[model samples]
Target: MQTRRTFLKTSGCLAAGALLAPNLAKAAKVKDIGIQLYTVRKEMLEDATGTLKKLAKIGYKQLESARSDKGNFYGLQPKEIKKIAGDLGMTVRSGHVHIDKDWQRSIDMAAEAGQTYLVCSSLPSEGQTVANYQRCADAFSKAAEACKKANLVFGYHNHEYEFDKVDGKVLYDILLDRTDPTLVKMEMDLGWVIVTGNDPLAYFKKYPGRFPLWHLKDMDKAKKESTEFGKGQINVKQMLQNMDKSGVKYFFVEQEEYPKTALESAKYDYDYLARLDY
Candidate 1:
């Protein structure tokens, strides 16, 4: 059985080696940033394909899908979505999915759709105890194993609750400690980390290359909701600066609550990131 401590040690060495890898330098150039479709949920609900085309026209190169009323890929079949996004010169790299009885179906659909990641959008159960987190990790590891067989990566996205302490230990740490690094990866939500008064960099330093995906969001301190990128307190530039440490291969901009229309906020976020120096 692979223990968490051993997994961390092995993953740390791999992360250190990856830091000097040529690809790390290449990734620093910031090419093809993606947007999570949930940011424009209303528009997507109205017209999924058209909304995607608009995003592509706005210079988005990648997309992450969310479960919608129509289906997991917004009313379109998996292959249909892949074709549409491909036609628009954008790839559906990942999607937010539930770790439910239908998980294998989700994985199969993702594989067929050419998606590289199947991220569990939230914790499957309600408990916040360490034991509960451990159980979740075990379940995730099994799911990840199945994902590997399908040639897809399995990841978990976090919210503020994961940061709460249980017996002087962070619940998120328990999950990271319990899961196999090779089997499971993290999609760090930058806004939620700040909202919980935790630092995303600290996790990057602790887990190194384990975080390959990110929800690059900013939070309005006053409203405790996602806002346009620079309008929030998160130091977007600083987070980008530590990409090497975080080992972020791809990131998706996601905003849950916007002052303007979702499409307009999405455009604003794209422009903000495009103009960012790092």
Candidate 2:
């Protein structure tokens, strides 16, 4: 009883549904959103325990610790931090660490903390050349082997500099191409990608499932700095919609600049993400 026009309409509807179904499934699987503690660095330095409690109360279910003057784990030892976060119904699964000669020490500490990831926060050496980046990739592979032995995953967090072109090829691409994918997992910073005028989606497409972690910070287009979620130029909802393509297992909310107190801004970001629907 169906006419040709009706059959065509039904087929188109089914195609659209097929396209949307995967994204919806990925979004629904996302739970236990995390925050990079550096967003509240000052407060954390003064009162690590109290600040973590506040973040936990705000519904953050995971954390990524940043190095502090007090210590790598913010004055407390690795085991101590793990216990505190665990008691609060949260987990400290990753931390930003420097890739230095003492990297093995960092790895040892992270393993003791029950953390799964040790992210190199910056390039170990500074160079804007393809050769330099390739060297860095070699070093990362070595470190990643140590991490594998320690039963931890190693990753790198990129900044805008990585996007610079050398010899007409992006430096980040060189790093990606040279490094072993299993050894060097990338922790993509969404804000920096926008600030550098690069497309995160392009990277996701080029290197699908390589990014297991993300720094979900938004950039203020005018200031070119981090800002509270939903108040920036980044299309966060679009990114979340394509999370499956990025292979993101965990993401951390991080804002370096705030319109108000850090705690208040952290709460705002949490609420914004919690309310956002992909």
Instruction: Give the TM-scores of the predictions, in the order they appear.
Output: 0.89, 0.90
lDDT of 1 by residue, 35-123 (tens): 99999989988998899889999999988999878778888889999999999999999999999988989999999899999999998
Candidates' RMSD to native: 12.3, 3.9
Instruction: Judge candidate 2 against the unseen true structure and give its global Cα lDDT, from 0 to 1.
Output: 0.90
- Residue 175 local lDDT, model 2: 77
Colliding residue pairs in candidate 2: none
Q: How many residue pairs in model 2 have overlapping backbones?
A: 0
lDDT of each residue in 1-278, candidate 2, tens digit only: 99999999999999999999987875543467999999999999999999999999999998999888987787889999999999999999899999898899999999998999999999999889887898899988999999999999999999889999877898999878998897889999988987898999999999988899999988887788998888889988888888889999899999998998999999998888888877
Model 1 alpha-carbon miss at residue 88, Å: 0.8
Candidate 1 regions with alpha-carbon error over 4 angstroms: 1-29
TM-score of candidate 1 against the unseen true structure:
0.89
